[model samples]
Target: MSAEKIQIFDTTLRDGEQVPGCKLNKKQKLEIAAKLDDLGVDVIEAGFPISSPGDFDAVNAISKLVKNATVCGLTRANKKDIEAAARALEYAVKPRIHTGIGTSDSHIIHKFNSNKEAIIERAVEAVAYAKSFVDDVEFYAEDAGRTDNAYLAKVCEEVIKAGATVLNIPDTTGYCLPYEYGNKIKYLKDNVPGIENVIISCHNHNDLGLATANAVAGAINGARQIECTINGIGERAGNTALEEIVMVFKQHKELNLYTDIDTRMLTELSQFTSETMGMIVQPNKAIVGSNAFAHSSGIHQDGVIKNRETYEIIDPAEVGVNESSIILTARSGRSALAYRLKNIGFEVTKNELDVLYEQFLEVADAKKEVVKEDLERLMYQFNQTVETKFA
Candidate 1:
């Protein structure tokens, strides 16, 4: 069977900018949007047009700039928000109006001060109104992860009947477990009428750090689109990391799922986004982190030196990195030391290496890492000592 193509709905500019101190100006948003298009994202959620004048302008500009991906603008389940989103996306070749309301009892009762029946009516009306402006209308059932499965199915059915082309089931609070989120999507697929006709999207957050797991689970169950942001930057804990989801599918071939993202651009884009947003990518972050392919432990370094697969599930080059780094730390072994030595133009016998290993450890213990200069100095001293003994 052919692999299923999972649509990558990147909300880097829209949702990611919500992080404090991570806001991007119009030029920055456009730069990222163009890169996102080149990276082969299916949808680029530009911004929430109704939020502010500056946001509206950015979304409008992005609509004109993007060539291939769908330029999307966010809105609430109200006419004014929907109108603003529609106006901002006027120049987009493929535009999407994403509008929806909160569906969970907590949101309905506390946030909206409304009831389920009334919320469903608002959701259906929003979808119908958005459909009038564009053929692609995505209806988000905000906080759907905590919403009762049966009531959630009802809302999805109503919105689909009202001309929604896509149904966005968001774990807005990032509270659902993987199995729970997967079961929720499966429930909708089984229960909601006309669900098969509309695309199912998973918009997950990372509060509990299960956003990627939940997204993958949702896809395995039935969802076709995964809504994520670059570096997982967003409100509170953040949204799912786009790189994480893409690599998840790539590495898990048995899932038979794939995305159009050029994996090689992941590291480059990640750095660009990090720099533009002023949000640093953590060194230990998956896929694009500095330490992702670096091996420091004695056992791990020896294994990687023999064969990359023994220590790394992903090739550094596959994600645009040059190669795996055998980081020379206090824990690095002889194999790792020899590998670094050969790269820097040095070949020593076993006895010579044994002698050097003692010196290397003394230096490693004094510093966090052993750099080329350090090794060169150590080798010079060893050669001097050899010459003195021979003399």
Candidate 2:
């Protein structure tokens, strides 16, 4: 069966840059946008054109540079914001105006100081206003994770009727459990009238570390578009990591879902995002971390050395890394020691290895790690011991 395609709507320039010190200049934003287009994302959320002059310029510049992917500018449910977004995206071959308002009661009461009816009216109006500028409009329910499903569905139905091409249900606060988020998307698909006419998108956050899981759940339950950022950089705990969701679909074929992302560019793009934004990706990040393909445990090293599939579900090369690794430390076992030795041009007999293992432990105990030079010195000393014993 042909796999269903999942549209990757990358919001790195829009949401990921929200990190306090991670702002990129217009030139930097354009550079990243060009790469994101090459990486095969379906849509690039360039920036909120109404936010600042720099943002407006960056969005406009990116709209001109990005060819294959749709260039999008964000806006609030206001006329001025929508107009600014339209003006910023005038150069885009495929321009999209993403505009919406909060739907959850908390946002309605505490944030907007508005009621559900007023919020719904604003949402429909926003979609219609955005549609006047561009043929493709994505309507995001700001904090839909906690919004009432029935009301959310009604809002979605109204927007679809008002000419929304994509309906974004964002876990704005990163608060929903995977099942809860999935059920929310499913509810819209099952309950909303004329929902099948528009693409259902999932925008998740990682405050609870469930953004990727919730996004995948949404996809499994029927969301065709995933809104994510590189390295998951955003407000608070950040939005979903783009690499995580793309790798999830690539690794789990049982779901029968796929994306147009160039898997090999994942690591390079991840690093580029971190570097350009002045943000650091965690060492243990899912797909593009330093340790994603590194193995230190003896058992894991042995398994990986035997066959990468034994310990790694995804190959390092698949994400643009050169190769897998076996880190040597005091915790390493004979198998890892042997593997490292062979790589450095030393092939010892089983009997020789038995003797070497004891001496290696003594050296390992004296240091945190063992390098190839350390191994060579140990082997030289072992040869001397063997010769002396024979004499």
Candidate 3:
């Protein structure tokens, strides 16, 4: 069977910019949007046009710049917000108006100060309003993770009937377990009338560190779209990492799912996004982190030196990385040392390596890492000692 293509809806410029100190100007947003189009995302949520004049201009400019992917603008379940999003996306070849309301009881009561019936009415109105502006209208049920399954299904059904092209089930607070989020999608697939006519999208956050897992779970259960951001930058904890979800599907072929993303651009785009937003990706972050494919431990280094598969599930080059790094730390073993030495033009027998290992440890202990200069210095001293002893 052919692998099903999952829609990658990227909200980097919108949700990601919500992070403190991570805002992007119009030029920066356009640069990222063009790259996102090249990266093959299905949708780019540019910004909430009604929020600020800067955001409005950025979204409008991006709408004209993007070619392949749909340019989307976010809004609340109100006519004013929907109108602003529509105006901003006027020039997009493929434009989407994303507007929705909170469906969960907590959000309805505490956030909106409204009841389920009123919330449903507002959601339906928003979808209908957005549909008038564009053929593609995405209705997000914010906090759907905490919303009762049955009630959530009702809202989805109503919006779909009102011409919603996609249903966005967001774990607004990043508060759902994988199984729970999966089951929620499954429930809607089974219960929501006309659900098959519209796409089901998973918009997850990483407050509890389960955003990627939950997104995968949602896909396995029936969601056809995954809404994520570059480097997982967002409010609070973060959104699901785009690189993580794309790689998960790539690595797990048994799931029979795939995306159109250019995997080789993952590292480059990650670095660009990080630099543009001033957000540093954690060194241990999956896929695009600095140390993701670097091995320093003796045992692991030996395993990787023998074969990359023994230690890495994903090939470094597959994600645009040049090669695996054999980081020389105190924990690195002889095999790792030998590998580094050979790369720097030194060849040694096991006995010679044993002698060098002692010196290598002394230097490694003095510093966090051993660099090429340090290795050259070590070899020079060893050669000098040997010459003096022989003399």
Candidate 3: residue pairs that collide: none
lDDT of each: 0.95, 0.93, 0.95
Instruction: Give the clashing residue pairs of candidate 2, or none.
Output: none
RMSD of each: 0.7, 1.4, 0.8
Q: Between candidates 1 and 2, which one is better according to TM-score?
A: 1
Off by over 4 Å in 1: none
Clashes of each: 0, 0, 0
- In Å, residue 122's CA in model 3 sits off its true spot by 0.8
Model 3 residue 282 distance off true place after TM-score fit, in angstroms: 0.6
lDDT of 3 by residue, 125-170 (tens): 8899889999999999999999999999999999999999999999
* Cα error of candidate 2 at position 81, Å: 0.7
- Point out the worst 10-residue segment of candidate 3 by lDDT: 100-109
Query: Who is ahead in lDDT, 1 or 2?
Result: 1
As a whole number from 0 to 100, the lDDT of residue 90 in candidate 1 is 98
